[model samples]
Target chain A: MNQKLFFTTNILILTTIAFVSIISDIGAKNYTYKQVNASDPWARATSKLAKTGAVYIKNIHNKGKNAVKITGFSANIAKKVQLHNTVVKNEVAKMQHIEFLEIGPNKSVQFNPGGLHIMLMGLKRPLEKNSHFPLIIKFEKLGNLEIMVDIKNIGWSQKKPSNYKHVHH
Target chain B: MKKIIYSILIILVFSALSFGVFFISDHYAQKWQSNKLFKAKLYDVNGKTWSIKSLKDKLGIIYFGYTFCPDACPTALNNLTIALEKIDSKKLQFEPIFISVDPNRDKPKIIKDYLSSFDTIILGLTGTDRDLKSFTFNIGATYSLSREDPEDENYLVNHTVGFFMITSKGASLPIPYRNNPEDLARAIEQIKSIQMSNSKFKKISSIF
Candidate 1:
């Protein structure tokens, strides 16, 4: 009976240790970063003399408990990468610099034309369509995510209205 | 049945009254916003003096932006270029004018170089701070300059994003156009309609 009791105690202690280790492994993971899904990354092509352009991405945070903040961005094509928001007030469109963009858990943030975007300043060369470039996005919690931005033509986001008809004189 | 009829009657009367009020207010608002042309002297890319009165006989599309603008101005200008290319210039005498809000950075040479990337026909104009203020304010356009350092060459100027259509009579039509082919086409149609009506009115008056 004594030997049996000792055997039972050892098994119980081993099981507890295994369970705790599993829990700790999950807890140590970078949960906030794992939940961030970025897609549809694109940049507008600039002219030869143009030194700046913008990049857009659709960021979706899957985690429902914590918000993810985009802290910084880096691209080889530009000398400076800054997060910007286009604010339209009283018919005037103003581009304002933002420190970070926070997306709530289970929410999405679309960076598109006439809205929030990543400004790429001092471009080394003009962005050409069908060409891709690497963009590293740093997050407050998720760390850094490397994304490939597809270069598109100017006014790529503008779609003709369905009711539009050609005007002829 | 009588109560329901009374409620229906009251709602109808209120709806009509509200529609009438909105229509009248909109009419006055449009009148207040239109037909006011401010005169200013601006320098073109060729260093020629371009007065506001010079645009009187032509249908003008005035755009307020800077040369250093990365996305918005270039995209807008490109769209204008495409739209102008589509239209027959002989049918409608329209001109696209790009006015620089950042006069400090957008000099004549800079404007000329910047505009060369887009349509060469686009007339690039710039003016002094005093000249821009009088012109922009009268046209209901606004822009702000943000400089982190006083001497920093890398600064941002946030200005209005769209284009304003000026009628041949030099009156602003109050409707702004986005950098889209459809919007430009629509504005052209409206201008043609106005031109037609004005010519008809002139003919009738001449007959009298």
Candidate 2:
């Protein structure tokens, strides 16, 4: 009886560890977003006719540990994928190479156009107007989630209509 | 015989004066004219004519290239965009202007659309191919075209990368010589310094 009880305890401990591991892996939120501070964010393409599409994903919400991983994502039209950041050095905007994103604890990160963005480089063809590209985002812990991004023309703003944004000279 | 000799002497004097003036002008133009970015009439992407002189107080970054450029032009533009962020808005301002060297393919609409991707302030300008070549060559600029794909109706254009920094008073500072990012930044900084100094010598004497 004693032997049987010890064996049962050992099985329970092993099962608990296995279940925790599985939960952590599957619980990772992939491409999850929420409001940063406000809904309005600056996003624009470098050209009205650029073969590329960039959007500002702001007020991102990726709480808890386990550095968020974004990979295995494919766009229907984009030939290559990259995350590009425009860092200011000596008052000049320089492109920096980035790989993954990490939002620690309650902190959030924003990917604003002309600043930091995920460049869908080398589009297989021009992204047609009125059509959206589905981005398959994968996370190490959360598995996979997909987001459909709208390709807006140059000078596009997420701000509400009837708003006149100032053009600073 | 005396009358003929006197007339010959007058003729010799005039010829010498003309030669002296011609030599000085040519030397000045060759040394200083090519570096200045002067204001001139340019066609917008909509084919409407415009000029940088319209922005009298602001400085302009004038770049010459085609919309169909595969890589360098866009990268240069991107670098310029990055470089502009470093400028202090209160002291000086830099506006980027895209001048299409290939007028055949880069129409007003195409140029406008290409420039629209960046900030709204960036202007896109183009003109007839002949006009573009004439204007570019006059500045000692060089460019060439190569077919991208014979199979396709559309083709690519390859050209030199050159940008001019023109101020409101019509003074131009040719930068990068060939579109190097470091050179661009240095040129902008130099412009900013000149503006900050509040120097009286803001206007250029020659136009290339």
Candidate 3:
């Protein structure tokens, strides 16, 4: 009888974990996570001297019928990760922290450099090229979705200045 | 009554025309004022006094930003480095100068450490309040820093995006910041050609 109870309790916990409705950092102790369908999610490689970094995602679409709110984000690499949007007025750039980001159904949001970005503060160490770190994106109703952000080479989004004729020594 | 109303309407139209003229002239004045900033004294992080005048015949690119800026500054610097590298012609002498508007937190040592992330050699400069004001005002670059308290270490600074490409004659062309490295490289070449023609014209005039 005890064995049966134990088996049922383990099944319930598994079900809860599988749903992934629990909060980040406490629930879903396992490393297994569902992938967030995002496009070109990457962070720029940083020098060792840098204490802050920025992350970019080309597009994040809300497939659900209802609107979803990205309440917060957590990263293991940085001390803090905040949603930030840069507004340029009369050539002046101002970065503002967003309390939360909402995505309407069938709509997409872009996180790009010099615009919407994920600002990583108090970086524990420099982010290297081709490396990746796990980022937990918390949603109000969708729960926590974990995504791996790859660190691309600096200026990867930009084109080469010109075809190298080797004039620049 | 008719005469008085006509005079008032005439006066209103004259005042409106003058206001429009002033606005147009003021905008052009700021663009032309960069030549005067060529003489502005810039104190580099190395405790060296430098000026656009000292750069002489080279194209000088000036960017005003703080070391603590996270998104725009780094991306601008990276893109600039690429553009410079692509335009690496021995005939086209160019120098990239980064001016720190937030000198309170961005000391010489801090600025040095921050600039090391890029591949190119950039001269990091900061100045006293008076000196900075003269240069920034003449160039029309604006910046503001907000702090919770005077002792607040983590503060955000809002600054103008883009770098001013100063030609050999001190005439500046403002290039807005974006992901277009090709545009930057092309602009640099265009400036070089214009400078070349100006020099050629100068030499011919001297012969006369």
**Which model scores highest in DockQ?**
3
Q: Estimate each model's TM-score.
A: 0.67, 0.47, 0.72
DockQ values, each candidate = 0.23, 0.13, 0.40
Where model 3 places Cα greater than 4 Å from the true spot, the runs are: A1-36, A158-169, B1-40, B89-91, B167-169, B190-208
Candidate 2 whole-model C-alpha lDDT, 0 to 1? 0.56
Residue-wise C-alpha lDDT for candidate 2, range B1-208, written one tens digit per residue:
9999999999999998897677668656644543333423468767788665666677777777776543345556766765676554343466778888777667677777777655435788876666666556655455555555666424435454556766555445556442344566777777666654533432232221
lDDT of 1 by residue, B1-208 (tens): 9999999999999998897676667555544444334346689998998765667666777889987676567767877777777774452567789999999878898788777656437888988888787777767787889887999776899787767766544455434555466687676667657765865654454432
- lDDT by residue (A38-91, candidate 3, tens digit) is 655678888776778888766666776777788888898888889888887788
Off by over 4 Å in 2: A1-169, B1-41, B88-92, B148-152, B167-171, B177-183, B191-208
Ten consecutive residues with minimal summed lDDT in candidate 1 chain B?
A: B30-39
**TM-score of chain B, per candidate?**
0.71, 0.66, 0.72
Model 2 CAPRI quality: incorrect
Model 2 C-alpha lDDT per residue in residues A58-93, reported as the tens digit of each score: 445556544454544456666655655654333233
Q: What C-alpha lDDT, on a 0 to 100 scale, does residue A100 get in candidate 2?
A: 66
* Interface Cα RMSD in Å, per prediction: 2.6, 8.3, 1.7
How well is each residue in B1-208 modelled by candidate 3, as lDDT tens digits? Answer: 9999999999999998897676567545644675557656777778888777777877788888887777888877877888888888343588988999988888888788878767778889998767787777776688878776978666788888878777655566666555556787777677667766855654554442
After aligning candidate 3 to the native by TM-score, how far in Å is the CA of A145 from where it should be?
1.7
TM-score evaluated only on chain B, model 2: 0.66
Model 2 lDDT, residue B72, Cα: 44
